[model samples]
Each structure stands twice: as C-alpha cells, then as structure tokens.
Target: MLAAMAATEQQNRTWSQIDVPDQSGRVVVITGANTGIGYHTAAVLAYSGAHVVLAVRNLEKGNEALSRIVAAAGHGAREVHVTLQALDLTSLDSVRAAADALRNAYSGIDLLINNAGVMLTPKQVTADGFELQFGTNHLGHFALTGLLLDRLLPVRGSRVVTVSSLGHRMRAGIHFDDLQWERRYDRAAAYGQSKLANLLFTYELQRRLAAADASTIAAAAHPGGSNTELMRNLPAIVRPVATLLGPVLFQSAAMGALPTLRAATDPAVEGGQYYGPDGFMEQRGHPKLVRSSAQSHDEDLQRRLWTVSEELTGVRFGV
Candidate 1:
C-alpha cells in the first residue's frame, strides 16, 4: 500500500522551476537572449547559479537583458556572472566572430542553447543570400554549434539545446531543390522549414557525437504557443482576433521557456530527445518529453541537410 501511494504521488508530481537543479559552476551561452523565451531561459539559469552569456545581435538590448537577469537573480548568497556577446544569427560572419570570441573567453562551456530565431515574415533573405528564416534559425545555429562543439566535448554533462517548434509539423519538409525558396515562398511554410531544420540539426549532431563516443549530447525543444514578441508577425487581419483570444491561444514567455530549460538542465534528458508543453496539441503547460515530426527523424534527410548547411555556411564540424 505504501509503495502504491508513492507511485501515485510520483506520477502526479508537477515539475516546476523548483525542480531546476543547481547550475553553479556551469557555463551557459544562449542566443537571442535579449527578449522573450531566450531572456526567460537565461534568467532561470542565472538564478539557478550558472554563469550565462547572452549572445544577441543588439549589444544594447543584450546589456539590458544582462542587467535584468542579474537584478532578478539578486545578490543573495551567491553571485551569478552574466555577460553579453554580440551575435547576429542571420550572418555567418557574425556567427563565426561570436563563436571565436566565446571560444577565446571560455576554456570550456557546459551548455550552448540555440534559442534565437525569427518567425513568419514577408519574403526576405539573410545577409548570406539565404531565406531569412532558414538562414537565421537553422544555418546560423548550425555553424555556431560546429564551431563550439569542441569546447563542450570535454565537459561532462554538456548539452547543445536547440529550440525548435511545433510548427515543424505544419507543411514542413526539406525542399532540397528549392532550398532558398527562390521558386516561390510562403511565410508559414518557410518558418516551419526552419523549425524542422533545428530538430534535424539536433538529431544529426547527436548521432555524430555518439559515433565519436563523446559525452556531450544534443537536444531540441519548442515553446508551444507562447504569446511572445514573435507573434508580432501574425497576419494583420488575424492580429485583432488573436489579441482578443490571446489569453486562450497563448501562454506566457516564462512558461514557454520551461521546456527548453528542462531539456538543457534535466540530467535524465538523453541525446536526440525533443521536449515541449504537455497540454492540448502540445500547446501550453509544463515541460514534458515530446516527439517531433516523423520527417525530422529521417537519417538520410538529416545527413543531406547537414551537408547542405556545411556547404552554405563554410563551417565544418569535427565531431
């Protein structure tokens, strides 16, 4: 009877911020951490006692976020180091420079959270002449990970957590022939492709790390339907309705960051795993181990995407 009671309690347990283990002495680098889900993720990690680097495109905003994180974490018993590193995920040049700077600054890194990304925007291209969403969300993070994987390889319990999205399942697939969408473009489809790429990158990276017999693991997560600044790009006609239904349609950014935090810090998390909310349609709730689209798990497609990403970014992964 006692065992049954304990089992019931365990099954009913709700994982919250309190479940986040001590992160002291660990180093965390989060991109696009100046706002929204990234900011919240950084804040939680900083509070839990990790040295965090906010890699953002806007140094000014990054500084502001750093200050906010420090302020929120407070100077209670221990001090958390929070710094800013300028990184523009849309440009390979910026990604390379940021990676070099980070590599020079830290002898080892515990976590690299590829959380920066763009949403549905009108037809646009990155500085590297690639689709805006695909280049910034997928190629940029891919390059950064390859550049920094060595530093994390030797660090026990190190993780590369890339933030993907449920949108990965929405009209998303690898369009090899039209990688850049030069033939045609749909904002939603393009965003879906980028999110799907994030998962593909994470899985492929995990496979490589495993093949190399490395301890560092790669994981992926999604924010669910959080009402973050990313929603600003919602079609104008739907904006008003979305605003009216915001309370029902979206959860807070702090809540959105939970799945990512869990994936990054949860010791039980394994390589090639994906996490997201536990609510309806995996939309909003506490973090839970989740499954990504079937297409995302295709090994051939993942390998092909890796090759294409390497060709486009000119960055190679030693793993």
Candidate 2:
C-alpha cells in the first residue's frame, strides 16, 4: 500500500494503481489479455493511464476485452489507450510476426508481461509439434521475450514479467529425457513443467541481463488459485471437488492479478524476484514477495533450458 515496501509488505495490503506511481507515458504489452487475470491486469494498467496492448490469439475476444477495459478505465476517466495485437504463442511464425509489429511500432517498451498460458490439458502439441502446454506456456513466450529484448534493454526500469504457477512445485521438473512428453503424457505433470519453465526462464534472463549491464530486468509472479478459464481443462473427476471448494479457496481474478501487478509496477522489485498471494499456501490474498521451489533456482537446469529453448525456437536473446 505504500511506495516504499519492506522485504514483504503488510500481509493484507494490496497495490492498486492508486498507490503505484503514474504510468501515463509507459507502454505495457500483455499476452493473453482476453480474459481472466490478463484482462484484469490490462484493465488496471489502463486505469493507470498506460498505453496497454492486449496481445491475444483471437481478435474478436480481444476487442470485447478492450471494451471492458475501456469501461474499467472509465471509472478513473483517464485518457487511456488500449489496443490489441494478434499473437498465437503456439506458432513461432506468429511470435515473430507479433514481435516485428511491436518493434516497428514502439521505439522502447516499458513492460512486457508474459501472462497468457494453458493449464491442464489432454495430450496435444503445438503447430511446432512441441507439447501444447510447454510450447504455448513456455517456449512461445521464451521466443517472444528474446525477440523483444532489444526493445527493452535500453529503457531504464523496463521489466519482463513472466507468470508461473503454484502447481510448478508439484511433481514438476524439466524432463529433458522426454521434454515434449512424446513417450508418456500426464496432463498435470506437463502443466507443471511448463509453469516451472516460466520461472527458470525469468531467472536465467535476469542473469544474462545483469551480466550485460542492461537496463531491463526479469521477474516472475503466480496468481495462486484464481477463478479463471485456465481450469476449464481440469479432469471430470476433479471438477466437482474444485467446484465445491472454488468459492472457499479461490480468489477473484482481479485479486489474483495483484502479484503480477506488484511485480510489474513495484519500484522495489529486482531481477529474479517472485510475487504471489500472501494467504495460506499462496492460494488467495493480496500479493507479497514469495518463494519459489528449490528446483526453480537450479542454475544448471536454467542454463540448459535456455539453450534448448533457443535451439527449439531459433530465437536468440543477445543480452
């Protein structure tokens, strides 16, 4: 709630743009902004007077979200600019096209939030033939961020915010042996690996940026248990229990977006920092600096994943 934050700010306090410094001239690009946490993140940043770009795979849904965000921004009645960019993270061609369009348009970018992702899903692969969850959630974002790093490196205080998940800690590790689940596929584990990749990417990118003495930084955040479309792919057996506990355990998407907003906008945030809900088990509450799993901090795995990502996507970040 205050501009100056302690190691972990007040357990219950949340940061709305009301407490954040003005974002009038900033350019914020957010992926998966059509619904859920991404939509809320765009709305709040629009309310803060930033030029918010809602990057979505579906332009129609993006337009609808644009309308809602405009209304939300109207509550503050700030002259805000909210637009959409076509992006399908499942396709590398799409990632390159989107990155090119952004580069041609903006001279510098302030924030690039890799917020879109898929959760549990049946065995599937991307247009590139990688597992659906891993390809879209991790690889797609990996390529986009790398392609856009040049746009951010020169901007002071610019940040790349990647959203991970609590499920990353549950039976999750980078399965280099079967990276795409070509041999065996478990929906939960596949989702876990993708989420874990998000953190690994964030930390590794931050390291590279620091090594190059670049102005940009990388941070990660998790929404905890938020009521969003991500769970639509949950198995039938677990749906009923999740439904029963949803009201008690899940926070609204707006509340869930706080950790991301904090990580993206907080003045105190540093490279490789993580933010998440402050409630029990990080399920729901206002956000605060949070700890990730030990595996997420493994340097060797981080470097390996980065190398493999570059090889797979063919997009290199010369940090």
Candidate 3:
C-alpha cells in the first residue's frame, strides 16, 4: 500500500523547468508583460521560440521588458520575436482597441495569459465606473477574451489562462448587489472578490468551450506570494511588514511565474484546472495543480457571474 501511494504521488507531481516544451510557431499574448511574473513568463516563452506579444498599459515599460528578454535570450534571441502592444484593462474602450489590434496583426493566438492585476488598492472606480479591482481584473479580461474568441477558436490547442490569487480564499464572494462597492469597501475584500471572479470566469469559460466542442480551453493560475509590483497597492502598514519579510517569506518573480507558464503550456493540463506553488500554503515552490475553495466550483455562481460579466463588458463569447 505504501508503494502504491508513493506511485500515485509521483504520477500527480509538480511541473519543473525541464517540463516546458519548445513553443515554436506559437503566438502568445500576455497582459501586463512589462514586469514581475508577466515579464518572466514572457521571457521564458520567447526563449523557447514563441512569438510573444507583451500586452501592457505602458509602451515604454513594455519595450524595456522586451529589450531585457532579448538580452537574456543571448544567441537564442535571434529566433525569439517579442513585440509590445498597449492594453489598458481599466477601460473597456482600450480593451476593445487592443483586441482589435491583435486580431489585425495575428491570425491566431495559441495562448492568452491574463496576468495583470491590482491588489488591495484604495476604493476607486474604473473608467467604466465599476470597482477598480473587479473592473480590471475580471471584467477587462472577460471583454478581451470575448473579443478575441474568434482568433482563439479556430486555432487548435488554444488556451485562455487567467491569473488569480491566494487572496481569493479570504472573505471572497461576488457582491451582486454592490458589485461596484459603492457603499462600504474594504481593500482586501475587494481584491479577494476580483481574484475569485478570475476563477469563476475560467471555469465558466471552459464549460462553454467544451459545450461548443471547441479545441480551445480555459485555465487559471496563481503566483503564490512572490515579490512583485502587484503588492504596491497594499495598505501602508502592510507594505513595510511585507518588505521586512520579503527575503525569507517570498519567492522570486521567476519562480512565481511557473504556475502560469505551466497552465499556458503544459500539454497534459486540462481545462478548468488551477495551478499554484507546491510549497506550504502554496506560498513558494515549483508549479503544481492546486485546488481552489469550494465556492470557486459552484456552477450556479459561475453562470451568474458570467451573465453579469457579459452585461458589464458588452462583449459576448462565441462559446
């Protein structure tokens, strides 16, 4: 029995650096690819010979990231094609425009990584007048994915990988009545809701894709407490504590990106799967398949969220 258990554990194991396959001929679009986990993901994919489009809000930062990725690629850089495209997730118009630009430039996208997000920010509304976190983290990606559905559907093995967070476990639920949080707002709770929405979106998208019999899939991942810019929005008090604990408690950005890369590229990965770190509490380690909260798997909630997201974004998926 012990031997059998050990075998099972080995079969259901975490993915490592050697597990990543060559990505030649693949076109990957990663949002917020200018920094942190996004940048690391883009760098690795580019090095593996994929055409990586860094969909970022800031063109200068995106170009800078591209340059750094190229420099890191060394002689392999010749085969890597990294381009920058402006994408501001806070605005519906910007999301639509960016999707349109991508559709015009690329015939198909093999991977779409929704990796950009804000964390624990003070109460604010997006240009669309929705809560900042929900609007950008969930609604924005929903719109972009819907707009790019045409490009993704026709391509074999296409995928949409949304990045959620461990924070999703904390007091997180869809606030349908106050989706915008116009009444009472707690920064942490708002961030949690947005992350939970990411998972809900991913699961619903996968269901729709399967129903449509499309070759594409949807998946979700989390960075698992890495030292990244996403923490810049944390409360002032928490920021200093995080800084002091950074070295010992947090993993590097590159390590944090593994789960996302695995979700996007792993051949054995199934639709609706969530990836995170293999370490204690999923804080830091190599990438592995991880279980989300019970709420994340609620089908009724997923459908409701999907409908509301469609209404807000004004973009409907073909799936």
Candidate 4:
C-alpha cells in the first residue's frame, strides 16, 4: 500500500529539446501558435521537418509567427512547411469552421495540440455564452477534438495533446453545479477549474478511444511557470509583483514548451499520461512524466464532464 501511495518520482532519465525525434512527413496542428510556448512548440517541430499548421485567432500575428519560426529553423526552413489557420477558441462556430478547413486540407493529422488558453481573467463570457476560462480552455478544445477526431483516427499513432497547467493543483475540481459560475466568480479558482477540466477531458477521451479500439490516443502536458503573455490577465495588483519575480521564478518559453513536445512526439508516451517539468514543484526544467491531482483520475467525474461537454458544445466524438 505504501508503495502504491508513494508520489510518482521524477525519472532519473533525462529528456531534452534534442531528444525529439525527426518529425518528417508528420502533420501537426497547434492552437495559439502565434506566440510564447505554442510558437516555440511549432518552431521546434517545424525544424524537425514536420508540416506545422499555426492555428491562431489573428491571422496577422499568425503570419508573423510563421516568419519567425521559418527564420529560426535556418537552413532547415526549406524543409519546413508552416501554414496559418484562423481559430478562435472563444467561439464554437469558429472552432467548427477551423476544424472543417483542416479536414479539407489534410487527409490525416499526426498531432493536434490543444494549446491555446486564457488565464486569470475578470468575469466574462465567451462568444458561446459560457464563462470565458471554462469555455475557451475546455469546451472549445473539446469541440475541436471531436470535429478532428476522424482525421486522427485513420492515422497510426496520432495523438491529441492538451496543454494543461500546474495551476490545476490549486483548490480546484469540476464545479458541476456552478460550472459557469453565474452566481459567483473568482478568477483564480475559475482558472484552476478550467485547467482541471483539461485533464478530465484527456483521461475520458483516452478511455473512449481505447474502448472503441482506436489507434488515436489522448495525452496532456503543462508549461510549468513559463513567462509568457498568457499572464496578461493576472490581477492588476498581483501583476507588478509577478513581473518583478518573473525572471527569478520562470523558465524560458522554449524550455516551458518541452513537456508539450514530449507529450506530442515521445514514442514511449501512453494514453492519458500527463507530463511536466522535473524541477522543484514540477516547474522550470526538462520534461518528465508527472502525476495529476486525484480528482483528475476519477473516471466517473471524467465521464460526467465529457457528457456535459458534449451537451454544451453539441459536438460528439466518433469514438
């Protein structure tokens, strides 16, 4: 029992940027690829010879990121093929349209990285009328995955990798009764709940895929304290302090993206596993397989959330 109860230790084995396998001939779609961790993830994979689709809400910014990624790839840029797709996670219509566009463009997608998110924002609703954090972070990705699952299903070893966060460790769980927080609001708590939802979605997805005997798998990863624009919504009072401490507390966006890259491409990865940094408190270091909160592993909760998500988005997976 004690052995079973022990926290999963960081593997002594190391994984780094160079460890990512050649992605030649692979097709990857990464949301929020215009900047920060998403941009870095797209860049690295492009450098490794994957055709990366930069899914962003803003085409102008997406084009800029494409240029930057191509330039960063240097001579490898000739081998890199990166394109831009407009994806607004705040809107279901946009999610559907983007998925349709991707389907028309690619016969198979090797990886779909649900990496876009909003954090710690003031109370607001998405274009779909759901609370912003929960809507954009969870439901949007849920719908996107469902719409794209068919494309992934036929591809051997294809994966849907959702980028969750260490923030999920906060006092959080699925607020089933108050999912939208229509009665009350706490930005931090809402953010925690959304991140938690990311895990639940991944676990439930993997289960359904397995039960259906599908080749596609679901996994998740966290950036773990990367200094990025995602923090723009931090409370005004806390912003200055975070800014001052950011340099000391955060890793580069490139390093922060390692866990995601591993989760997306690692040959050893299994469905439903979560990956994050191996450093203290699971922050600021190389990627390693990590554990999530017990709530995240609750199969009943996962199924319930999956059902609620399908109801809300009106999108059902083929699995």
TM-score of each: 0.95, 0.96, 0.95, 0.95
Model 3 TM: 0.95
lDDT of 3 by residue, 48-112 (tens): 88999999999988889999998887873456799999999999999999999999999999999
Off by over 4 Å in 4: 1-11, 76-78
For residues 12-41, could you state the per-residue lDDT of candidate 4 as single tens digits? 467887988999999999999999999999
lDDT string for model 2 (227-294, tens) is 99998998999999999999878999999998999999988789999999888999998888899999
Q: Order the candidate numbers by TM-score, best to worst.
A: 2, 1, 3, 4
The Cα error of candidate 4 at residue 84, in Å, is 0.6
282: Cα error in model 3, Å? 0.4
Candidate 3 residue 76 Cα shift, in angstroms, is: 5.8
C-alpha RMSD in Å of predicted model 2 compared with the true structure: 2.2
- Compared with the true structure, the alpha-carbon lDDT of candidate 3 equals 0.92
Q: Regarding lDDT, does 1 or 4 come out ahead?
A: 4
